[model samples]
Target: MQAAQTQRKFRGKNKAPKWKKPDDGHVSVMVLPLAITDPADLARIKRLFGSMWSIKRAVQRDARAKVDAYWTAFHEREEHGAKVVRQRLGLNREALERCAYKHLDASGHLKHHVSKALAMHMAAEVWNGVQWHLFADATGKRHGRPKTGRWHDFTRIPGRARSHTTDRKWETFRLVGTLHGHKMAYTDGGQYTVQQPRRMRVPAAPSGPVLTGKTLASGKTGTRKATWWDHTGPLAVVFAGGPDSGRGDLVLPVRIPQQPGQWARVEHFLSNPGRWHKVDLVRRRKASAPGGWVYEAHLMILGPGYTAPAVRERREQAAALDRIGGVDGNVSNVSVASFPASLDPADGAPASTEITLSPEERALLEREAKKRRGRARALERSRRATNTAQYGPSKKQARRAEQRAAKGLKPKAVTVPGGARAARVDGVPKQAFRRDQLSVNYREQRARQAEHAASMAEHHRFRARQVAREIIAAHGPVLVVEDCDIRTWYRLWGKRLSQTTPGLLIAALDRECQAAGGRLVRASTWSTALSQHCLCGERVKKTLRDREHKCIECGLAGKRDLVSATLAAFVRFTDVDDPKAAYLDTTSSRHAQIVFAQGLEEALRESTAPSQTTVRGAGHAAVPRQRRETSAPRTAGRRPRATLDEPRPVRDHAGKPGQRPGCDPQLTLW
Candidate 1:
């Protein structure tokens, strides 16, 4: 099948933007490896490399766990959650719903466009495993989803079909039995083969003679003064004097054809482009003195200009003569001036910077969470199908009468020397009692093995097992948290989401803190999902619906629900927990390391000399800049935000997300 046509443009000489159209000769049709086929061995991939081929075994990363997708999810999900939070805050429902997904559905179209672009571009570096396919519709209009009864496997995941018919079989090579490195017919009537040879591929058009921009008589030819653009596109013809490079002067009118390929011969003859050649100033000595005249360089171009013929037949003849490099149509328009200036680079701007779950965390969420679970369930059904195939009745076994009628067989009892009893299998005679009759069982035995083998082969790969994940996080009161969040009430009870969200911190706890006998907790009013007490936005973990929850009412505070139940739900625990760690670390151990590094910069800055301390502090009474905001004396620990969704983000003078767009100018000033 043909791969997706994904291109990378080389615009002049700059890195092309992710989705912008690029200049020629720099694009590729690409797709995610996993999106195409199951994982393969390194040797096979290397063999496919076969010289000149790129062996980029990349792991496709999902957009959600990366930068933009994470922020988008938060904004979208909380926009939905804000309706209830607004209700609690004494705000009207319509105001909140206006920003909700239901009202802002058009944004989902932009989202789909962006997602399509991202899926086509921005692939990961090779060496990463392929990303699993995860289909998520933000418009999400589906209802009454049904569980499929048939068996499936990873190899059968639906995908945008890769059709081989789309490929342009531009040419064939004699040595390789492949088209673009794939098996295809050779140019000659013989079997093609691959051999060890490397060569650079220069871009070539399939038809007619072409022009390469070069200097004829040393006017200008350094990519700036001359280039090709014709054939129904724009056309410009100009003569140049002096050397082609650096500050060349233009001469009078030059000939350009009204049609494509008419002036190709003249263009080729004039552009004597020798490889690796460059333009440089030539020096000439005066006849009377030894010193050289800088401007006295030789110009091989004939400066004579011709008048245009008024008749069509003569014009056509002139064009034909020009095609023979005769210069018969070098008509005079007007004398040209100096060449134009080169296009310069634009001033660079600071690109967006965002952070979310690390690769490990994201892998667990996108691929490990749902897709892996899907494959597991599919395998479960597959295994059942295999069991049925291996042990279930065949048509021959189902009806003895039918088998007899088909074979027209009435099995005659045979008594050998040992008198062993035997029955014919589908009219195939079995061994009559000994190793002497081994050849008799071959056909029946082969059929049985073939049936069993076909049924069980699907399970001989990385199948999923039960996987569970939890994230536990804390936030400010009147603030919000989100996504696959794991809330712990007791040591064991919890709630988790199917995927990642602002609640990922809470969800993280399932893997990190749950082993200490903590239970995930959730509000009894909700199923630990997006709801009133959950995603609906409330801080009911400390205050109930009746508790007129004011900041300083009684100065009383406590967790309203157990923490364990919160951890279990939002995690989208397809299975109970991930099978990866189980497979890697053995069933008994599940631990990941957290390393600590000392911050020497802050340490050195803090330990600056006492005289330098003036820069650090206004006066002796001034507190350290690194000091935290002091808390007020209270009867209980301060609670998190009332709900996981809150309006607006913290604004700092520096900038949102701590990026100081204005701070860079000061750096140059410094």
Candidate 2:
């Protein structure tokens, strides 16, 4: 039987996986609130959670120690490098798991709090973090080292499975409930006759008792008999042993939403013939709750289904277009330009669109950000007030002391000095500070700040989705964007990038494109300088302040971002996987030239034209041109000299003769 079971497992592993296409299947999460009003039950649940947290902490501690030991051994070796460390340590998932398990077993009494299965799960989580840190270090990527989690950090614990025939089933955590339906009936001889053991319709509402097992009976007053309805019970999340053990199981009644739409959605998902996965117990802090926390169970369901109707329809429409587009993402906005599959630019000018947050949205986000900043500042003040000895003097206080010293007045004591310590290599403060004493107000402020941040993130995500959907709906699914490092943008324009969130929007677009049976192609930034070059095959270098693209070679001028996006539409790559081999298909440049001209003309008109309605955000307004010196007379081979009425360009600050003022001297004309 064991050999047959092993063979069956092998066959199952060899079988083809499902959901090869996005439309083939979908995964949805249903969050059901766990209602535990009884004090004893809540206490038991908290105890179980505490045990899980302890187990996780122990495992993480052990994993960190093991990583440190490996690093020490690697450094002690004759040859020490990423390759040598990998070869000597044999660092992989399996190896990390083995080490984690060894360290877990060595921690006395730590394994007894949870079952072997749960212990292994916690160890696997630790291995995940360790693997991330190790791989990042090996690849020379910036990543923080894995650290032990605190009590508040432990928010979730996953169950093994809903049910399994094998012993591997986590019998501790199980859902107990069933939805009963009315018996099917048919009219026979002008009378209704009930069909035995057949349900007609299940209850639409998740709550309320459901009646079943109706039978036909000959009664004095009626032809049918009434049956008792069974009530759906709570979820049994057991730990270590069964509920009959010393530590009883944590039983919390499931609370489903009563709203019509929500109930309908829940009913639909439950009624679907989808594979039931494991449930996860998640805890969230709520200041208004009884114990400042609320527990919820997340049900994972995977089956055949599509997303929202509107999104699905948009994707369908996008798939039929078969258009190719290019996206030029900036710190404040993103410009998109696309051409149809047929390269006939004569058909029409390429579709061009600009995406940016409107005034209302920006104002709303700014208000929330301001609130969050205030909350953060309040939290910091509370912390410093509560734990005066833990912090040192601020820079302002030090400066004030210096000013006092410069004068004849004595310097006042600002903050209690922390104990001095040895200097470190990482540039951290060489002082031994005491642990902060967190006050209730501080915790409340911190929680408020965190909640505000979460709200802002959700709002940003929603806006990004809307923008992505709009782009896909108009320009088709296939897109090409420059392979520029978003991190560099963050470093350069951190605040602006945070507000606009161009990276998030790009990610959303990529997801939408993939779901619509298309892809987001990344063209090499170095090879195809979309911003630096024009469609006329001329390299035109411009400063950051130069928002207008004016090509002296071809006299093609337009908005810088729009021009770049248009050029990106014609970009081609030798290898799609390798963006470094990107090039422009200049053969069809003439076709796009008309499109560019039309687009530029429209942009110029918009910039120069007076607007009747108020424009918000970055509107197409005229940019001020710098005046330069053009007193020299016109030569035979040279271009026409600027007249007295024409604006003169400013000379270079470096006093270079016969050189353009605004142009960078380091760059050569090509």
Candidate 3:
């Protein structure tokens, strides 16, 4: 509890204090370029970094070997004795660090502090690999210890030495890792002061004081020239052309390689030196720029903290609940039902909107999908060709090749042909070549493919999430949806069709619903029977191919999807006994018009007589009203039965049975 309190005090009220005012939860990156024009210095800077990278890679290789040996022993050991085996084999950070020291000591290329830093770095790498292997084993993604490879490209050099600069006055200020040294400025006519380093001890301080753009009153904060880091360190870096002094307060004596106006930004950083930290001097070669090699100093800037205003919301407040809306997530789209601010629950109706992927969006998706598949297929083919050439063919392939040769034709190259075990070269499998012989081009292609796949998947997910947000905006808090078996559907349909289904879309909708101060309720998949039943509890069975629902029991006929949607709303929000009242309760005026229009069309079609109809009593006069009233009240909306005088059969769908008139029997459904 005491530790917690101390942490709170250091972190302020919301978070760690920032150096800049009105700080947001974002980090701003700034790159400062140093003007180094000397050819010899540029070459030396590149060599320094290159050598550092080489040393780090050497550490990586040694660590990898230790990891491999540990895994080998782990597999050979019993599960109960695994920990003991690890300890005895010394598969830990200390062991790896000692191994790194051995390599560095033999090379004698770096200083003691630098060597210790490199050892710690190697130990950290081994530790990360071991942790990941354990995690993978727990998740069942990997069977045993996981294999690791050397993929490190950049060498990390530590900043801010602790042992040095204790009780220093500059340390009291929030100094961004600045080194105290002589200040160098650009001499006029595109030249700088050149000084050579001597073996003898230097003087206590330089005779002259520092002078730069910060001293000048009128200087722009932004610049128009290129620059880079000229010097970097795991240890202290002394400048060759700097003040050899004691008690010098000046930090970062910079030399401008070009005209004065270009480096105003660099001078600004130096003016308030305490705000920056973890400075790195980075060197790069750019053929496009005029300079053969460029240097840039990269450092993190500190900023001020931000505290959000207090918010107090009452649950019963009319304004808050009034703004919420209802959402309906379906297989291919999302629908929103929004109520007005002044809408009363007893007499109110909701306005609705639907979201769907536009045609252009779908077309672009198709094009990208095609491109991804093509890339995957090309990669697979290349892998197969390379494997076949290196490992030779199997028995089935060899037979085929012989047949082809007999027919005076060239045989196709096939990798791992059927019914043949992998060939062994000196007791090692020929396929082992795959591990070490992967071409650079192949690796590059795989990386590009992985990146593209990630990008496209993210883009699709973002678009879906955005649509979900819009749905919540249109609708108020409560969301009602029917649970679907998406995995089952994917299995029944093809994977491509599954992609069009609302699996991810529904998830996005749920997220947006929560974000908009609402909740989602999932009804059972049994509720989907709405497509086959009327709101009045009458059953109308529909086949998989049916697109329309015609309920002979209650005369509720319309497009199957719309009917299901209306019934779902009714079941959830209104009485099922009286479909008229339920429809009015759940549907908006515009939606009612559409439902009524379809009903009217169905009624008109039903009332019309077929081209030929059989009537049992055509010769007899129409039944009397009194008789009809007494005899079962003549089912309303029913077609007349055949009479004795007119004994002809009624036909539909060009004289076929069970087909309705004025409707195509072969209309596509989904």
Candidate 4:
């Protein structure tokens, strides 16, 4: 009877659908705090982590020792047969396990899965070392033995490398448990509760009914209502169970940090249950927060779905017919120009801008450097003071004490510079805490400096992106940029590299272009040769000292960079070949251009400018013929005679003396 009633309700055309289909949604992890109501449990958790860290350290040490021993043996008997070498140095997996497994099994409290995971992580590191050595032997090794003291050698690499041990005390634990619906449990007595969170959707008002625009005419307008719905995710946080529960079981309840309305949504999700996914354990390490081990449960639930935004395809449309904006990214600043082709060439000039660090930012950097210097000075002074307080006895006093001991006489009292407490006699003193506190202060100060620098860089990048968007919007949708190598600039200009980050700016522009239904065209840096004029299909080369391009052939005069930008736009939208092709110097590979997006060939045919023609057989490609000769008539073209040293004519291999060795005698080489 209930199914018949529902079918009867949807029988007519005006009937409403039973349900709406939803789109697929994405998953994200939500971080939440764990509630630890018992101090004893917290202590146990701390002890557990400490023991795990010790085991991790031991594993790392054993792996490194094995790697060092294996490498030493390989180096000693590199000429021996493979079988003999394998026998001499037992470097197989079984041998390694035999050496390291004993230590892992000795720890009774360490879980078996935890030990296995830790061993795998350490073995991965050892494998990486082996791979590095193999690569070094292949590439770094020249002649016979490998290069010992080269700059790229691993041993010669600068900076300290830490293995296993780190400042952060957190470890990622793989879940070994069974999950069912909203409830989960582990063999080791660990458990957690899971649920879905909620979020507000678009076209939603805080709390009200939807309104029509007609009410505004009567001066009684109101906003539309916003919709609230359940938000589903893959990761559900697991918190330690609250106190006053069962003492024998080890289980944690789901405690999410969210608004009250979200809490209600979670409760609804919990009531309905869902499919189990995965669970991850993370130990919170924040000094200010309540400390406890937290678990993140991954689950899938049936609820409202979501669809990702569509990515616009790259195409030429009416939207691309706007003015062009060309950006020249330099080491110290960026120059941008947005203009129409109809605009006067004389009026076209790029505007340059740069970011300068504020006084406060600079002060923070200086303060960090000063603190480090002061710490070094203080440590040196403390070392001297400690030596004076602990060992200030004279040579005669020391000899008299020894002589008195031999004669069984009482020794005189010795004086110290400061006090006995100033030196470490038995163990570390309370005053040692001051040094540790100083070290922490230094670290915090350094962190603050780094944070400030990062903020400044982000601010500059945001500003540049904003300016690029505005220019593209006002002028045209087509963005032209030069590909830059920021690393090269960092090496050549050092600190000045901060003022310009071409890659970051270009990436930001790409996103803005995609959002605006436009496209970003990255031209070759060799387009810099555009600074030279192309007259009669010939390029005129000039030195860097030349700021202005004065082409005598075409009588064209303009600023170098402006001409380069114009030529860049022309080369992009047309099929004009680069005139620098004949003169490209390949000796230094550093300045080579990295290829990027090229303009469409169809756009070239649509252009009004005349296309260039290639004169293949012409001599002296760089110099124009009109300049090469003034007295000679235009029709009289001369060809240079080939020297004897040039390749001889190809003879027939069938005992034909007149023919050269490689080619047919009838064939004429161009």
TM-scores of all candidate predictions against the true structure = 0.17, 0.68, 0.42, 0.41
Error of 3 at 371 (Å): 3.0
Residue-level lDDT tens digits of model 1 in 221-257? 4343222211211111111221221322121111122
What lDDT does the true structure give each of the candidates?
0.22, 0.60, 0.44, 0.39
Name the weakest run of 10 consecutive residues (lDDT summed) in model 3. Answer: 619-628
Order candidates by lDDT, high to low.
2, 3, 4, 1
**Stretch of 10 with least lDDT, candidate 2:** 608-617
Q: Which regions of candidate 1 deviate over 4 angstroms? A: 1-206, 213-379, 387-502, 505-554, 557-670
lDDT-better candidate, 2 vs 4: 2
TM-score of 1: 0.17
TM-score of 2: 0.68
Give lDDT: candidate 3, residue 550: 78
State which candidate has the highest TM-score: 2
Over the stretch 1-670, how does candidate 4's per-residue lDDT look in tens digits? 8887777333457354443223554333333333444565456445444544555456445655545665567655567754465445544444444444566677665542234544444444444454454345634752322122221111110111111222212222211122332232211232433333322111111245655455746777665553221112221232222121233212333444344335444443344432212234345223233341332333333453221111111112214534455555554333333444433323322221112233444465467557757766555444434444434455676777899999998876664322334435666553553343234444344444444556656665655554444334333456566555667777877654543455566676676665566666665556445445432234668786775666676445544554444444443433223332222122211111111101111111111111011122211111111112145652454322211112124233548755323431110110
Tell me the tens digit of each residue's lDDT in model 3 across 321-370.
44324334444444443433344433233334433444554665577678
